[model samples]
Target: MATGNKEIVRRALEDSWQDPGVFDELISSDYVGYDPALPEPIRGPQGAKDNFKQYSDAFEGAHITVKDQIAEGDAVATRWEGRGRHTGELMGIPPTGMEIVVEGLNLTRLRDGNIIEEWSNWDTLGMLQQIGAIPSATAAQTR
Candidate 1:
């Protein structure tokens, strides 16, 4: 069960970025997601699809790579890296055409092979800086 749970999370992290439909299969109906980057918690499979859409719409050719995964009982932890070129609007900021790479970790709880809940922490500030939505530390200090 532990190994299978890890595989489930690995697929979710890698596949869901490009194909939000994957959430329909991997995320449970009661699924909820917590991310500091989000203004509100993500609820249900559709919420997951919308969350991924926000990023996919902003970053063209976006891809996620699962670096590592660990599972114990019904909980899975995954480390992942995402890469893309900012070719579309994001959070009202027009595209900067910058290539960005961001790393994050996700802790997921599964029930009956579907994701029940997940908590994610990622390099949101770094991504913002890369796309010029936020100034970099060096730029801020030099100003």
Candidate 2:
């Protein structure tokens, strides 16, 4: 069960970006996702699709790599790294054409082989710095 649950989460992270349809298969209708970068909680599989779309729209050829995963009972925690070229506007920051790397962790809860809930925490500030939307700490200190 643990291994299966981990695979479910792995697929969600690795496959969802490329194929939105994966959400319909792996996410429950009642699925809810919490992410620090989001202004509100994402509800249902459609919400997940929309959330991923936002990033995909902003980053061309975006890909998420699952770095580690641990499962216990009905819960799976996954650590991942995402990389892409900033080819479009994101969070109001225009395209910089810079390649960016961001790491995050997602804690997913599954029921009957489908994800029912998830919580994500990622390096939003670091990403902004990499894109020049916000200055890095070193730059701020030097100024």
Candidate 3:
């Protein structure tokens, strides 16, 4: 049996890669992604797909590497790094031809190989600035 931690991580990566039918194969109907940017939690598989699509569209050639994952029953905690380039429009910002490497942690709840809930801690603003979307005038000035 795949441990809950392993299964959840596998599903999360599959979803991130924008694999067709990933959600249908591994996610629950009432999945809730605890991302700060979304006004409301993703309510279903399609909503989850939308979230993944948003990410995949923005970060082309994106890759994720898991540093560590620990499991406690149904919940799993992970530390990971994801890297990609801004090859297309991302959050209303056109391609900047910049690459971003982000490191973050996430905790997820799983049941029956389906994702139930997740909380991700990532540097959103830092990622934006790295990709040259956010104004880095202050950073430039400081430098």
- Encode model 2's per-residue lDDT on 28-122: one tens digit a residue: 99999998877899999899898888889999999999999999999999999999999999878899999999999999999999999999999
Q: How many backbone collisions does model 2 have?
A: 0
User: What is each predicted model's overall lDDT from 0 to 1?
Assistant: 0.93, 0.94, 0.77
Residue 63 displacement (Å), model 3: 1.8
Off-target runs (Cα >4 Å) in candidate 3 are 135-140
Alpha-carbon RMSD, each predicted model? 0.9, 0.8, 2.3
In model 2, the runs with Cα more than 4 Å from the true position are none
C-alpha TM-scores of all predictions: 0.97, 0.97, 0.86
Q: 1-143 in candidate 3: lDDT tens per residue?
A: 33755766765764457574777766789877887866787767788788777778887888777888888888888888888888888768888778998888888888877878888888788888898766676877987
Model 1 regions more than 4 Å off: none
On a 0 to 1 TM-score scale, where does candidate 1 land against the true structure? 0.97
Pairs of residues clashing in candidate 2: none
